[model samples]
Target: MSKQFASAGDMAEKQTSFTEIGDGLWAFTAEGDPNSGVIIGDDSVMVVEAQATPRLARKVIDCVRGVTDKPITHLALTHYHAVRVLGASAYGAPQIIMSEPARAMVAERGKEDWESEFDRFPRLFQGHEEIPGLTWPTTTFKGRMSVYLGRRRVDIMQLGRAHTAGDAVIYVPDANAMFTGDIVEDRSACYCGDGHFHDWPATLERVRRFDLDAIAPGRGGALQGAEAVNRALDSTADFLRSTYRPAARVALRGGSLKEAWDAVRAECDPKFADYAIYEHCLPFNVARAYDEALDIDTPRIWTAARDKAMWDALQGG
Candidate 1:
């Protein structure tokens, strides 16, 4: 099955849904697509993760307007993914926040990632021209930063290297809620293209230690209650374990990329077949897993050319 390239599809036109996770806290979810979180303070608001473009971010702005009139004061980047951070200018947030590692990754590979992602998932980059440029964090922290939302508190912590070197989570102790970037997902495909699979499970375990009543995952609906939170964590861990183990085994045996891909498919497809973006993520996921299992510590840079080449090799050019 040779991989086929299709022209970028139309941008999603559906209205994003905003669900209140707690008092003064909201989650903006669009279908099972990328999600953004909102925290309203006494004086202003902070938006976590800008969508792909200002046009898309304005939709989120509209959602925030429906809730309150407080101006947006902060824009946080969970990581330096093009889809998550490029639309930041839309908020006109004075302080853009991110972990120090995330900022470094942006400085290192942000441009390549921007070009690569736009090619791979153009639909997500609606109003691409609206992107002022790659987003840079005005404020960067080493481990954790406590942000005060008036009296309420939001703790942004860089727990571990999982989804990317700079992955961070926003925890609200008052609300007993956590907003995990791609670090945790509920019934959504894990994009392991730039992930650390072995470390991701342990990182997730760290996240499990939190006493969360609810969670707004990077993708999917807002999980309500402890049971939903646990399910999300367990499912995310399971997805990583299942995909990485088989892919690593085959790669260690000196199997070809296609063989590794087939091995992973046989192991994961039965369970994750119905999950979002499962097919879309498999090739890149297997490639990274294969590399890591061979003791490749860092994820290889993914450019648009490499994406197609890898797809062709694994799927039969």
Candidate 2:
């Protein structure tokens, strides 16, 4: 309780950018906040990753309006994180989608996640009061599903579990572009609270196989061109390895969580000190890594009280 979450005091507004990564494909990114993607189809539009709240979602909607007047017919949520799906109501899209596991997570811990995330970062939840309740997917798929916005085909698939158990990536074949939710971060730290560390690299490899020309990642700017996309993938992989190795070492050696924290910081700081959300994500990442190292396959749900207890335990050292 003595040390507040790194994001708790992050009240400064971030400059927003709407960049077109592919033909009719856009990425809406704030300085280091959560990001959203847009896919303008032949007739209608498909939006990827709703913002944290209605007011936040309105910003993406405004950006969408600037480019096309097409109605958003489908909203695809990559995962069940509150920051990513709580604002779904703003879209009012007739069909909202998520992976089956993601919806299951929503049923399991959606409220806890919403309360936990809101307490951790107030800036993202600007209009928290406007959020009716937990966002539910009108439709869900087990491994993969394809939706057509007229001629454009969006392949939403659960390649593997990385950021969450049911992470889905939106791949548009026409543009050879992919919208990777938190699975791929460009110059931003991956929030690994509910992540699967061992499964992440393999999932990322599944993404790399596409050899995408462009990508709208979960955070940071839009990745255009093959090189930038690959660089982000490599760096994200490196970040995950860097974070996990030290924590795993500590946990396997019967060291305390505090020791794991220090070890992880020692390894990650020099490399990712300036990355967006690096500090905010470290403790949770370390805790999860420690758990994963101890053979815990599933990530523990993060309630607000658990967040505080984890923070306090690490700070106690």
Candidate 3:
């Protein structure tokens, strides 16, 4: 029984919601869909993640408009995923900020990723025509950069790699809120197809050192207060550790890819099967983890053909 390739079979549009999670901060979440964030400064605004298309991004803009009239000044790319940065033009932000590696990623395989993601998740890319093409960041930084919207200070920091080679998190110290990209998810599946599986936990620990009162995850709802924030962090760490560690061990012992896949499923499925995109993410996640376990430090570029081949193989086409 072969499984569908990635999210190709998932076409249901999720219900989007905007929630006020902190002072001058908002979380735009779709029911188990890719999440985005907004931070309002006294004089300007920053959008954390762009939606899949310009049309979808307009909805996020409306959400921002509902609360404040500040001009959107900066659009931050948490990483270089097409769904997270392609709709950036919709914000019309003067400065599009991203890590250097993220910028490099856009240059490396941006077009291929765009077509691949569009093919996998058509519902999210409903307004694909509206996209101006691969979004290139106007500003690129190496590590930490401070952004100020008047008196408000937002710290954009790259602790280490997790979901991608350049995962970044936005922190508002005064508000005690953090907008973590795909580095940490509340309930949504951790799509590790481009991740650094072995180092992900260490990176999460670096993020944990900060005193965060609330967190707007890359997916799922905003986690409010310290307790909820801590829980989400722990859950994300557990998901990474549980899935990758076992897969790595299997690969180290020269186990079959299917064996590693089954091991990951046996460990993660019982607890995470109900999470959003779990089924869609598992095979890819396991494959990447297996590669990492076998001494492959970098993830292979996922083209449309590669995605289908990997899914078909592990799912037994």
Candidate 4:
């Protein structure tokens, strides 16, 4: 029944690749695992999207050490997701930066989310006990915040809500590189458990304005050049549209949840089946899309118990 739960039968370790997307920009991707972007400044370094735990974070730290000895001075969280923000303590980056909405999310559901995600994906949280609890931002800002990594301008700005209300991207103007959190996924399936489906496309439209030379997405390989970047962004948009459109059509016709779910499966399964996390995310994605189609603007909080219940019902367990 969809691997019983999230990542239940999948526990194989992935080969990590730390590729330099630009002169001073690095992207750490592990097959289809969550990616962490690196920006090497003239003086200190800045890390984007911390892994799930302190032990897992050490692997990223080692990769950074292989390139530069510069102490990381900033840890930028793209959102308030547990898997992305829990490992922040390992970086020891003095300043943790997040948008005001992100900080609010951390306050609203950080503890519940932490417990929920850990249960869902146990392998990613190899050192769960070491986590110092929910990661909090040292500094919060609204709209856009300009960060200078020795004149290499890293712009931390909120485009809109896609993956979460607090979703943000780290943009390096000179490098023509943008580090997008779950707002943009390449080959991996987008997890919409806490997403805003209605607003996701508009947020992606804002991402296009950057005229990117390279884009380090949330998962999968980094995109190089404008053409590849555009294609990746388009792919993300297509995913959102294909799911929401069909579901909305069903909901509008007063169809049942199963009808809505089956409609999405028939349309999206063939198109997205081979993508990473496709199986794990389908039910959740459909549920969110179903709600959004009914004009539910905000995403509902997913607890561990709720996750199992949803999966059981949708998977016909």
Q: Which candidate is the best by TM-score?
A: 2
TM-score: model 3 vs. ground truth = 0.97
lDDT by residue (241-302, candidate 4, tens digit) is 88888888988888876777889888888888888888777778888888888888878888
The better candidate by TM-score, 2 or 3, is: 2
The digit string of per-residue lDDT tens for model 3 on 1-317 reads 44565477777767898988888999999987889999999999999998888888999999989998989998988999998988888887569999999999999988888887877788888868878788998998998999989999999999999999988899998888899999889888999999998788898888788868889999998999878888888999999888898899889998888889889888998899999888878888898999988889989999989887886677662
* 145 Cα displacement, candidate 2 (Å): 0.8
Which ranges in model 4 have alpha carbons more than 4 Å from their true place?
none
Query: Which candidate number has the best lDDT?
Result: 2
RMSD of 3: 1.3
Every candidate's CA RMSD: 1.5, 1.0, 1.3, 1.3
Q: Which sections of candidate 1 miss by over 4 Å?
A: 5-15
RMSD of 4: 1.3
| Residue 280 CA displacement from its true place in model 3, Å | 0.8
lDDT of 1 at 21: 90
The predicted structure with the larger TM-score, 2 or 4, is 2
| Cα lDDT, model 4, residue 7 | 78
Model 1 lDDT tens row, 1-317: 53443324435555567999998889999765789999998888889999888988888999999999988998888999998998899997559999999999999999999999899777787679878798999999999998886787889999999999899999888888888999998888899999999899999999899868889999888998989999999999999999999998988888888888888999999999888667777888999999999999989999999998997787562
Q: Tell me the TM-score of model 2.
A: 0.99
Model 1 whole-model lDDT (C-alpha atoms): 0.88
